[model samples]
Target: MSDPTALLQHTETRYLLCRASDIGEGEARGFGPLAGSRRKIIVLRRNGVLHAWRDACPHYSTGTPMAWKTDAYMNGDKTHLTCHSHHALFDMETGQCILGPCLGQQLTRVNIVVGDEGDVFVAGPTEEI
Candidate 1:
């Protein structure tokens, strides 16, 4: 099996995942080609800012990829993201496990920067939090 941890450490090829405008304010979405691996990423727009986190739920280690009407938003509340598998709610701003069995645990944060052209790029190191 591939070491997820090491793959995360070495995956630094950030790509222009999407346009900032595409993700409306308080909306959450998912992007892929995450730094170390080829897994999908969960990106959220909270308080008018973009935040990216690994789509996997810490409790069950299930990959919650970006999909419409699925584990995308939190119970019609666009303010937070949710894992469809167990209804685990995560803070859009901090990617913290605000609800569910993984309370106190946080999703892996992906470093990204929005360019002046309104393009989102997965830039910088992956933080293991």
Candidate 2:
């Protein structure tokens, strides 16, 4: 199994995921299955801040995408990131799984940077960097 934390960290190349304004407060969106990975990159807005995460649930070995459909990365309440596969709930701020199958596990976070012009960019996978 791959180490989620090591998959995409400290890279030079960056991909523009979206504009910061594209995500509304409490909204989540999915970007690419970037750099040959099966999983997409998830970007969400919470309390006026933007966060980026790898869209793979920690329940399985290689991990699986959390959304059931496109851009559906949150639970109904929009209070947490939800894994549709097993209904796991992750804390929006810290990416920690607070409930469901992967109780203590956390989502892999990608480096996200918001420019002064409001463009949101994520660090590319090692291969891309």
Residue-by-residue lDDT tens digits, candidate 1, 9-128: 645454677888878777777666545664566667777778878767777665544344543556565555776667777777877888877788887787777878988877764443
Query: lDDT at 128 for candidate 2?
Result: 26
| Full-model lDDT, candidate 2 | 0.84
Cα RMSDs, all models: 8.0, 7.7
For each candidate, give its TM-score against the true structure: 0.73, 0.84
Query: Residue-pair clashes per candidate, as listed?
Result: 2, 0
- Candidate 1 residue 66 C-alpha distance from true site, Å: 7.5
**TM-score of model 2 relative to the true fold?**
0.84
lDDT of each: 0.69, 0.84
For model 2, name the residue pairs that clash.
Answer: none
- Model 1 is weakest, by summed lDDT over 10 consecutive residues, at 63-72
